[model samples]
Target chain A: MQQPIAILDSGVGGLTVAKEVMRQLPREKIIYFGDTARTPYGPRPAQEVIRFTQEIVDYLLKFSPKMIVIACNTATAFALETIRSRVSIPVIGVVHPGARAAINRTQSGYIGVIGTEGTVNSGAYEQALKQLSPHVDVVSVACPRFVPLVERGNFRSEETYNTVNESLAGLRSTRIDTLILGCTHYPFLAETISDVMGGQIALISSAEETARDISTILHDKGKLARGDLLPVHQFCCSGDPQMFKMIAQQWLNEQIELTPIVWQVPHIG
Target chain B: MQQPIAILDSGVGGLTVAKEVMRQLPREKIIYFGDTARTPYGPRPAQEVIRFTQEIVDYLLKFSPKMIVIACNTATAFALETIRSRVSIPVIGVVHPGARAAINRTQSGYIGVIGTEGTVNSGAYEQALKQLSPHVDVVSVACPRFVPLVERGNFRSEETYNTVNESLAGLRSTRIDTLILGCTHYPFLAETISDVMGGQIALISSAEETARDISTILHDKGKLARGDLLPVHQFCCSGDPQMFKMIAQQWLNEQIELTPIVWQVPHIG
Candidate 1:
């Protein structure tokens, strides 16, 4: 039996990553958890977000996954290192892959990043970029409003476009040749974001880049699943099973086995 | 006291990878070996190519590099596993990175690969692609003439264009939406190859992708150089030093420290 790659997110945003992982590594099994009971870990305190992420990881660990992907930018910003120390298996975060890709794509040395408030406040992307190349200039913004829209499945609406346009107005003026969609939820609104940013600025999707990194790391370790048999994937959510199922199916374009977990953190919601 | 990344190729072809590693990971130092005395490893027998690559790896090991990059496609196709087993450090190759990039870019599932006779005959790219996804259709062609042109320092002449155009005619006719510049030497001729293949096909350069992989692997290992000092790189070749120095400076757009090594292999050249 192939050990699954476990993925966890604050909400539906991580479906973007799951979709790409499936597309890129078709043979690998996946087990995903969404903390919809307390969605939008973006605006929460760092400690709270880290605690929630640890809980989800602990729950996912029951299946003995080969790798854990922190698909949420906010959680990756706050909780990646702590989780890395706690887990023996390889744990990947979305931030560095996005940052590395932005560094690769940017010709002007100026990069723009848009993420959740928590992630922006953490300055993860900036740290990751400058750590790799000190000469890079980073511009970061917090888009606290975008995640709710994505969670509600309000993609492509006029409100979505207007919000995206107004939110990115400051970034549009910069001479940034590359923009990193620093949040996993951001890719759901990529068309709107692309329309606002125009054709010149290359948008780096953390979801796509993270999946590619997963492939690279797994291939290096000789852990990639080699069997030809199709692997079954499992999806779990902490709240509102119907809404989670609806959005996940529409986003993933397939039916998923979703198990709705009772909220274990009683004080949060 | 920084441990440099050791990159070796059959000739100056590996300079493509070296230049990218410099651009993307500016903080890291590099020690590069180009076996120019007996280059064009494409037409050689697999065992001979393996022995030559092992020799280069043994020579490069003297630098105590943190990682070994088999930057030539033919050498990677023939000798990566052997080198990896022989060396305790991480061993990276050009093929898998290019294959991964091609897989990421190809929407039509039809991919084209052009390399020297050895890489094409080894079927490494097809195997890598199909191993990841069983559905991709691969079109492989061996361009036996492109390497000598690059080695001779002839990049943008009309003769170069005609040679590139003629060599890729069969590939241009295919439905491939992505083409892998399978040989590290191929990127020097990218503009002409792009012109021949047109804009519809996305070109995947192994050099750039390999550099990105190097970053990913190094970051994961917690061994990325942290100092702010400007890294001085060293380049060595086993053949004509003048032509090698001229081409290296021209392609890298910077003056490089070059050393000429007396040819150690008496039987080949």
Candidate 2:
């Protein structure tokens, strides 16, 4: 059961979640597959996402993974249930972890969730929050383009910060003390998100929580690659190798030998 | 000889240029193509961009445009020479026009250029400016993800603004009297960029210059569409239609119906 952990995304947005998982589980090797070919499950119809997620999970299963993490917020919302039910190994979704973090961090009992349209629409966050603390008020805003923004590595520009400010204006007025960056790619914008929200609000990222969940599941299953050595991480993207490499360096803050992996995406649900 | 004009980009960044071209050339119809499936060509390698640009140009050629506008800064920098030389119709790059605007707008000798990494790496602005006036001190910085930041409609985030502040800190400290929004998508962040540079430094966008160039070229070639009614604008992309539509609406500030145009992007150069 020492097979590599398989994590898949529609694009590089999921790398944040995968990177955290890699950090927590240093003994295990991670096989990160970014389907940069047809990304952005945020705005697509639910059925299409279900089909796309199933295809990638099915593709990753060929690597004989010990466990799978749906790091993408949209896919986690749309396809997590189906994938978890069908897969033999443990399947983890990011939404619950994000919800738990928000509930823990919020002292005011008000939490804000900002993510892609599909993620916000799925009500996954709301449902998770309510189940954890039925008294907590949840606010969700869909920022469909944030993933591409972070993936493009534009987090440093005045325009990017301004966009973050403008994008969060609606959420700011809500007076939520804790804001959950519900999408994995969004952690890249934490600095800007925090600056806009100022000291009054907390910006919660699911990266660490998701990582913990991965460890818990793998430990329980006797699949933990227990070791002290730093794990070798492989990043594969279907988009331009150079662009992927540059973003991989900036966002991941480390050099990665990015290889192109060609997997025939099966059109199945 | 009257025919539609073709404008192609990796994404909706080109629309600012197209919008300006529309203002100046009211009678001409535009065949606008956004390769949102592979948007944000800034960080990609030149070779891959050439391939992507070539494929999109080939697709746009099916409409038989009288001329083409490489409205994307990254594309203009990397593929202009190859694309212009290969295509039968005239090809206009945004660099020359943007550089011209930067020179014209600067009251002081110091001017700054901000765009995608590919554009900054091509040294297109420095070369163009030196050609125009060697004495002008041009400071160039690569705001790699600004376009995608804009595309994601994250236009007013404080974090996005802070990133802008940090990325441009080098250029702004040099006491740049003027800055060029070298990429078409940058204008959407004009307010943020302007604020970061302080109220003193003037900012220039290439959109107007490109529009004027299109007008001059069309008028000179005797291919200007002459009719009381404006020409129809068609939008196309290589990626998810729903998300692309989200970007188009947010950027264009209007609803749009985009047709999916599948492309095989072998490489960029």
Candidate 3:
């Protein structure tokens, strides 16, 4: 009777997927966990990110969510398969959404992706794009600092503007009609990324497509939570309560209570 | 000679403080944890948050760092006292640093505090401000939604912009020149908040102040870590790693090697 969908991310970024899911599916309650303690899985080695991603999936499984959405590009790249293999529930990631959006929006047949080193290095978006449209060429840049700048609340800072411009400078050499904000954090700099890249370049967030995927999956699998007028959202953070709450409100535009959960690493293999 | 400082937040929000600390203490290395799985400690009851914060503190203490900075408002409000009184090491919260900043910048003779419900309800910021300036008047708003918006990277959305405006609409009647971002996530909405309230209001972020506090505490207590320029960062999440990496790199602007750590909750009582 209680088939909550668990949406987990390193931080608030996952809310994008959660919000979309909320809009797309009114009956499903969501249990969201943002590993705010150790976020930014991008630059880390692949093994480490995979292991870290597993812990969240395992923890959220306690709620016995019917499905799990990675809601992050890095997780999709490194951990989706492992998560799917370890758990019985359906697992999803953001890479497919980004790819789908890129394929749908590109008029010039050229797309660009800007994300953290890990995401760019993993070639997740490129691979996804190739699968969707083999003829389309993708330009990828490792936006190493965009996430930090957005988290620091400096997306509009002159320095942030310059940093984003610097990171995106490569795309200027080629025309890209559709630009995927490959990383969730990149949406914060959407205005900046758009202003620099121009209005013509469509700034697509994978959130909408991710939400659509959840709907289709639920409909096809008969896993949608049944009978809940207002779905409940439970937020968990591993770090401090204050920062997590502040960010949640700013991101979700809803005032929901977040209960802190102690996550002790009793065993790390 | 591993003297890496320990920094923990629910997610990358604490990295703002960590970034400043790195600039201040270039020679020192740091160990950071963002409980990205479960974040936003504001709306929850005090006891739960305290327990959660304590677990991370206890976990990080295993490294035996000289000091620990709970660069989060909710943790400071709920458990900073207990942690400071009981822990062997010097424990600091971001609240005091921002409070000090508010005291210094408040020219209108009136101050406004905005943070998670826990922080405002706990009266931590108000009390901290009063401790510095007993006569000052402080208006506190428990902005529970700000964090989600920032985490979702919706700082520029119509909903987020509207929310910021709604939160600050009443604040203008108070004539407060200085506003403390009371929560780390509020800073992410700086543009919207600043635009809503106008730049005439100086937003005080505790990131730098908290760094200074940690530095002072470590210097005064002689608990600063010794040796090694390894400067490597270890991150852990209670959630998925893919989303974590995206936000981490964008918000923290640093490369980290994240490792898998199991999350266990033995007993809540």
Report lDDT (CA) for all predictions. 0.92, 0.76, 0.74
Worst 10 residues of 3 chain A by lDDT: A260-269
* Best prediction by lDDT: 1
Question: How does model 3 fare in lDDT?
Answer: 0.74
Candidate 1: residue A28 Cα off by (Å)? 0.9
The two-chain DockQ for each candidate, comma-separated, is: 0.79, 0.01, 0.01
Tens-digit lDDT track of model 3 for B1-269:
56567888766677677776665454566778777667767787999888888888888887787778887898888888888878876677888777755665566768888988888999998876654444578998888888877666566899998888887788988878888887766666778888988788888877765665564445324455444343676666666677767776766676766776535422311
Q: Which 10-residue window in model 3 chain B sums to the lowest lDDT?
A: B260-269
lDDT, candidate 3, at A127: 72
Candidate 1 interface RMSD (Å): 0.6
Indicate the DockQ of the complex predicted as candidate 1. 0.79
lDDT of 2 by residue, B84-197 (tens): 779888888788766655654465768888988988999998977664444578889999868878767788899789878888888856978888888888988889898888
TM of chain B, each: 0.97, 0.93, 0.91
Clash counts for the predictions, in order: 0, 38, 68
- The prediction achieving the highest TM-score against the true structure is 1
* A184-261: candidate 3 lDDT, tens digit per residue: 777767789888998888888877667656654553344555562566788887766677687677767889788645
Please tell me what DockQ candidate 2 reaches.
0.01
User: Which candidate do you rate higher for TM-score, 1 or 3?
Assistant: 1
Candidate 1: C-alpha lDDT: 0.92
